[model samples]
Target: MKTLGLALALAVAMPSFAAPPVPLNTTDVDALVAKPAKGTRIIALWALDCAYCEQNLKALADWQRKHADVDLVFVATDPMSQSVTLEARLKAAHVDTVPSRAYAESTPDRINFLIDPAWGGETPRTMVIKSDGTRRALSGALTTARISKLLD
Candidate 1:
């Protein structure tokens, strides 16, 4: 009786652990992008200090909930060593279910160029890649309307 209650309380008190972010490197960029999305894939690039990044993440997460076919791949601009912080942020945004990656080894510029040469190295930037290889890179807060337009 008492033990059961105590066990339940402990269970409720425990925080759920999300998987650590995988390391994303320059050499692996092509392979990651090569895997086609069944529908449209969103490669969201964000940084911990970017204020608008959170808004973009939430908007994407909301869209994902309503669209199962949309694949989300969150890439944290910060190094993989900061996976804990990145994971926590993604978890809070409710997008951790899709998993995420953090930059590794290579310099940030190299990774940025590899992701998209036109990407002006900005946080909250998104790369909309379709199966046919048409890619659109957007910078700043990505709103619901902008996310929807990607499908169009």
Candidate 2:
């Protein structure tokens, strides 16, 4: 079927990063937002237990393939000790090609607060920040339309 071919092609196009994630502290996030490295940075916050995170990652990775200016950064909110699981999950999604991070500190609540006080410790939270100090966020499994809206 045509859908099967498309799926196979997407799988081939996306390769696993398979590398361990770097440690992520609040300071690191603050510094990145203060000076984004690319035209737009999309920070995806996910956890090992979140069922929808992989789907979001795969979709976002596909979108990134089409948009050269969009940078996708993934952060596992789980503790750094779970790097093995993090790496495995990211590999499964084929989003290991991009830079990834794991929560370095143990205080998840505080880290989440530092990332965004408005957020309520939700999984699969996505933050889209632009170079001009403007940003938007959406939590939950993102739809193509919602992802597009975040950029606009």
Local distance difference test, each candidate: 0.83, 0.85
* Residue 84 alpha-carbon offset, candidate 1, angstroms: 1.4
RMSD of each: 3.5, 6.5
lDDT of 2 by residue, 8-117 (tens): 99999975445699998877868645537658888889999998999888888888899999888888899999999889888777688878999998788888887887
Steric clash count of candidate 2? 1
- Model 2 TM-score (2 dp): 0.85
What's the CA error at residue 23 for candidate 1, in Å? 0.3
Candidate 2 C-alpha error for residue 84, in Å: 0.8
TM-scores for every candidate against the unseen true structure: 0.84, 0.85
Runs of candidate 1 with Cα error greater than 4 angstroms are 1-16, 35-37
State which candidate has the highest TM-score.
2
- Candidate 1, pairs of clashing residues: none
Worst 10 residues of 2 by lDDT: 29-38
* Candidate 1 worst ten-residue window by lDDT: 31-40
Q: Which predicted model would earn the best lDDT?
A: 2
Candidate 1 C-alpha lDDT tens digits along 1-152: 99999999999998767688899988889976764746778888999999999888888878888988778888899998898888888888867776688999759898888888888788989888787877777888877788767667
- Per the 3 Å backbone cut-off, how many clashing residue pairs does candidate 1 have? 0
